[model samples]
Target: MSQSTAAGDAVQAMMRAVVVTRPGGLGALEIKEVPVPVRERGWVRIRVKAFGVNESEVTTRKGESDPEVTYPRVPGIEGVGVVDEADEDSGLRPGQQVATMMGGMGRTYDGAYAQYVSVPAAQVIPFETGLPWDVVGALPEMFQTAYGSLTTGLDLRAGQTLLIRGGTSTVGLSAATLAKDLGATVLSTTRSPDRTGELRDAGVDHPLTDNGTVADQVRELMPDGVDAALELVGCSVLADTLRTVRRHGTVCFTGALAGQWSINDFTPFMIPVGVRLTSYAGEAADLPADVFARQLEAVAEGRLRVPVAKVHHGLEQVQDAQDDVESGTAPGKHVVVLDD
Candidate 1:
């Protein structure tokens, strides 16, 4: 066994983790005493301080994720912590603060739903911040998806008008703030008018209520159509979202919040002429360390907001966090914090 240290404290042989023996309800999540993960030559062991509950994890729990997930798995797609161990050449040192997400963290291997998790060194992003663990834990996956969708998927530029198809989702809110920071005009959608204030607080310039369709409402606000659109509600409304973009504008498919992943009777003709379509499913590397650091600073300075809906303490609350996420009662990121 390889012994490691976190912030000068000796790493324990056994750690508490949330283990899912099989896909089912929230009851499937079991807190167990498990052996601490050991890092290989190209891996780093993180002493997980906090993690965020996401819909992907919810799907994984319900046997709805990709087939790569196996039984006896720890489910967490994103986490923030201090390094407990690392290879000398891994460009990471013991005690370094870091954040990790995607790149098969939770599905193919044991993930961040533990006191410690070992992951590929290449997928780890080192960052420094004075913000609380709950705030930082909510960032990795949400920001990665939003940033990738806006920059890589859409190539959204300053002054461009952008529409977020699912404005109340965590990623949608993150996109609103990021687009605002880039000097873009944002028009977001919500199925309920009651949630428009959430979009406005996230920097959305206009919040349109979605009643199965909103292209006409979007067109009314921007006669020439928006310069870009982000589709999070899935394929059911994708065509309508595409209609809200200009002829040469782009639409980035990044989420399936409405639980619709595919479209029946789909045809290439569904896309408008000269309107490009793209998608973003990125990993930790998709988000740069400097950008993460800057955003954390922004949060600290009150220039940016992390819409954390709830924070649960310790591994015991993992079930509650997942339940809140599955219920969709919480409108923003749900986080779990582990205290020593």
Candidate 2:
């Protein structure tokens, strides 16, 4: 890590950042000192402490543009930091701790891969959890995504049934936690045979492995079929997910690791069955302040358990982190620690 220069040193204006020169693999990333972003009116500058890696952001760095990607960018989507500077109008102040995130962070702007970043003041969410930076870093994207899909996208009711694909993943697990807390019956899928029991321990009542046909397994569990399906694995099992859902049921597609498959059987079949296929992309960047505060409270109080599989050192090691996330070695969240 580069040391900060003396007070009033113009050199301190620059910060060290990890840059993706090209998108082949981990070897393509490099660390270099660059100009620190200056705070502008209505924006806040944060000194990044830790950042979380998401599969979509990794795919974005590798040149996926579902959210649109630009080259030579930083590679972290969610992170925690202390405010370096704040815009007065936003009611945020310097030295305040906060978390920030949105769609394709590193791909869109100079992102959390750098020591410093400037984002709209409104986009920053304040937390008083005092949780380790890694866990805090992992929360925003997964939490917001889960919260939005459950409450907004699917309009999940208290007694509805939810089936989550990739149940072992961070998003999958987080959604399970939220649904359970909301009084829903949670059924989930795990590719790993060993984790099926673990999912039950984590609040998912019915867990299935990829080997079994999802539709049949779910039917055996809920003969009436599920009210909703959270599609994190994408096309490979989308058809099966669609089949397991009840008439007028909804399936929200949030991730696409299993290859984007066409819903060929959905044309006439979906209408007759009353199944709804909804592809949820982005979320409201700014969560309701009270809900976000409660989320942080859940993390601190242990109601929300965020599992971190690995934490690498700084921006330079981000490629390795990305590799771990992509290879499925990360059992939970993969993070990049920017500070000691």
Candidate 3:
């Protein structure tokens, strides 16, 4: 249930959150009552309505502790909620709906897995009309990453050929939809033939399997070779992706699902043919705000569909949601819906 900031002064505040005491699996996450967040200057307390889960969050949670996280942390990267409190000095007001991507939440900072969270005013953004719970919830991590890859990491342009390796993933589909909207030809890959129709509906011109022949398939589609590649499949095919690019073409490798790859040498026999290889780490500020707004508009207009792979109720269900996301049962995105 939504709460009002006006009541902040009168009551003892406590909220529920999903916390991971130690990173292992879903069993490590537990629901507990925590203090309601209070806004600091230039920050606002968000009454988190929904939070989107991603694979990166899962990996970080289970991996060895690094400098970014200590034990007993909340794990949520992106969130959508109403503004509970705002700095009067700033233009923000209470009750404005907003969203934020994974700058620090759920990693180095407290995140939206709780009923309430405090984030910088600049990080919080107001939403226009028609922003749905599912869509807004889904935007933070995947959309921002896609925005980063296409705009910042790779200077994707109209009429270029893009090979998206993970066609059905949240980030992968976002890239495909974004490229198609920008007037580019998007060729994606899926592990299942059953996903072909869905990929087509999502605007992918061609879909292939990860059978080590994606390069051959891509060559058949474009004799000139792909202009760029969004490599979600990982480093195992780095050479293959490079081969698919035209002479002097670019390859933006984002994620590594294929396994560990160490590039000891950048110059190989391919140098004679001319291919550019670069590693991409999501979006930077290079992606314009108007571009992100356009994607949001598409979601609002039904052009972008944020399918709920699975919905788990209550903070206790956070682990189940994580499991579902990892298991890949849900089609698009996995969301955790807190009970009012």
Candidate 4:
């Protein structure tokens, strides 16, 4: 515990943070005391209370991600916290509640792995919430991806039929939940037969078990194909997902859990005519502040729920938490809680 300050001239404070000395194993997770970030014009510093562990972080930790991911970096992509310092023009005051995520976080720059993070004011979304820090921390990326993929990527609508290609995944389950909330008949799939119940509990109406040819299985239920689909498994299953939708229907490619990043033998004819194909990838700045704020409001009002699969206190368990998620044992979201 060291005393440090933000902006250097006025206040002083200190904070704890985790650093990845290099991309490797759990040994890379190093916790230490660091200076509280200094706020700049058009930027704000947050006192992080909690953060979420994402698979993207896992890839980065293993050195298998982008070459731009420099090591000895603080690795956190999303977090919930209070404003430690902000200029009035930032539209946030000290003590204001906000969440920080994506826009170059944990990759192009130092991110939320610290007790305090200074980020672009646009990337810090202000909101009102009484939810626990773990829950708030876990919601942004998963639900925002869920909401964006459907609302923007696929342009999903009420009374539509949606098939989540990899339903048991966190994002898949989140898509199912949001689609159901939008009045769609949600159908989801799982590679594990044992997890069908989990998908159903998450609001998936028709839970189908499939290893390959998931589209064939879907065809059995929806002979004319669904109204829309979200291909979560990536290229290996994308063609299958595309076929599961009717002519002129929509399909959004959002995830690549199957590890196939590119499509071989891909041709224009392979995609159905008039069948819209779209993808969603965004930074924190790309995510509308109003969208993030609305989700927080919905969760506080009990109109929505962001299920955290597990919550580990302190930065010490970050490695364990990431390993657990990599092992595919986490049921939903894994959150890391920090003391206020």
Candidate 5:
């Protein structure tokens, strides 16, 4: 049978959807019944089991995403679930477990905050694992971003000293765990001194509080500066973070939680000779399937960790989830689970 014909053989008509009607706070989100997405020739429909509540989604809800983000759209860039519909030739089939993330999802296109989501077939990552929905749901986007940034962006080595400037964030903790596994000495940071223990338990060898002189504190510890630094706080502190790296150290900017976007006054001379500065904004296709599968294997084998700071029951609780993520008090990421 043809691909489209095969997809037409099994599908549902309508499903529940959570929509952001406008750029507002939590009140703007609407949850109601909506038409089920039709599977295009090379697209796959996922029966979303659970999705992570990302800070990006929170920013989008507050009317602060990229200028091109459209209203009345779903605001989830990551999710995990079963394939409900797929063209036969799409290399996917009903009953398969998969994940979808990045690539205009929850930004310019309908996202995973719904009962169903249709995405390009190539973006549907297939995997086999016995992990529960909630645990696996939190992996796709955050872990892939962490893995890619560590391996591809920084080219991290086994014996280097690495610093995560925003270590308490979900992705930051993931990097700490992975870096520890790679035999790197990991130093992490949080704005609050109380959370230093939390970072230690998460495998951070050192946890420094950010008090405007964080670079000085790091220098006190390393003396020669770190081998690499992952900048998550953004341009406001980019220059300071750059100074905390060694002569030939690598610095990769992966996030902007500090409200500074552009480095308008930047100059190449600002960087020390032999230092390298790079940034990573992982796209949907940026997380490779092979790398993701290896991580999943590690998770299943009890070597890797997925630390969910909080869990909300269903779509109705997504507002609470986002509220917590915005509060920035959670030691880990918040997740919204759909009861199976």
Candidate 6:
């Protein structure tokens, strides 16, 4: 409508989308024809090519997400696609490759679970890559969280020792790959002994089994404790994770993979004396354009991996993809690709 080259004028007004009528089990997800979202002044409409199925969406479907999530909503926090429409001043042209995530998406408003999504211009990240749609879709939220946690949350540096508490998760695997590339020694944990090999293949230096607690094993590997630790298992194991860090080392909490959000009795003593505690819940801008482009190039050139566990073909497989993610049957990112 704003004279963008890729405006959707020739496309139909109605498109198929997976809608959650209300918070419930997998049965709550239903495929229905919904009007394509209209482009607003400060927003761009994306013809979604692919999107990753994340645990947060699973929580949204179960009605366990933050109070911001409402019924009959589309559930997707991250997507990669071409712009269908944009205002002339938005710096985004129609058909420009882009990615969007985490500015109240899928919760406060409808999100990428549809054929098209309208998102604020500020939250959209533009990039150029030759990677496939499924691979690119898996990168946005997973890579953003991992990159932000390492650089912003931990200030991780080369030659340092880093520990991932929930090593088998998509973010955990992403962090391990990035940390390894940064020349850090990675010690990652997994509850399943079978998945330790997966961590090793992801360039992890040490793969520790997580039987609820991993501090003892971590200390055994690094007598002085790791230089930094990433807490993805959540508050339930935050105290033990703190013990895995050396004096003055940092621990950054970024995910709640164990589904535990808060500790009943939190206290200052729960943290080590000289260790710093931080958390990362960042937006799209936290992952700079240069960083995103470089990572995409790395993946394209085979210097890095996307760690995609599976790729579902269309909206019909959305439930199956969510089920695989919720069940943890796969240890990496699950993506849904919408083919024309």
Of candidate 2, the 10-residue stretch with the lowest lDDT total is: 1-10
Q: Write the per-residue lDDT of candidate 2 for residues 94-125, one digit (tens) a residue.
A: 78888888844666777787888888776788
Range of the 10 consecutive residues with the lowest summed lDDT in candidate 6? 1-10
Encode model 6's per-residue lDDT on 209-229: one tens digit a residue.
999889899988899999999
TM-score of each: 0.96, 0.90, 0.88, 0.93, 0.93, 0.96
Compute the lDDT for candidate 2. 0.79
Name the regions of candidate 4 deviating beyond 4 angstroms. Answer: 1-13, 285-290, 300-303
Of the candidates shown, which would achieve the greatest TM-score relative to the real structure? 1
List pairs with backbone clashes in candidate 3. Answer: 1-340, 148-283, 234-256
The 0-to-1 C-alpha lDDT of every candidate, in the order given, reads 0.92, 0.79, 0.76, 0.83, 0.86, 0.92
Candidate 3 off by > 4 Å:
1-12, 64-67, 259-273, 282-289
lDDT of 3 by residue, 255-316 (tens): 76654445666556753277777766642233345665777888878877655576666677
Error of 4 at 262 (Å): 0.7
Error of 6 at 11 (Å): 12
Instruction: Give per-residue lDDT, candidate 5, residue 320.
Output: 88
lDDT of 3: 0.76
> Backbone clashes per model, in order?
0, 1, 3, 7, 0, 0
Model with the higher lDDT, candidate 1 or 3? 1
RMSD (Cα, Å) for all candidates, in order, is 3.2, 3.1, 3.6, 2.8, 3.3, 3.1
Give candidate 3's error at residue 208 in angstroms: 1.1
**Tens-place lDDT digits, model 5, residues 1-340:** 1133455674345677889988888888889787787777888989999999999998889899988789889889999999998888888879899998988889988898998898998788898888888888888888877877887789999999999988888889899888988899998999888889988887899999998658888899999999999988888888889999999999998988788888897898988788899988876577777877877888788777777888788899988899898887676878888886
Clashing pairs in 2: 248-274
Give the Cα error of residue 157 in candidate 6, in Å: 0.9
Ranking of predictions according to TM-score:
1, 6, 5, 4, 2, 3
Residue 92 C-alpha lDDT in model 5: 83
lDDT of 1 by residue, 214-256 (tens): 9999999999999999999999999999999999999999999
User: What is the alpha-carbon RMSD of candidate 3 to the true structure?
Assistant: 3.6
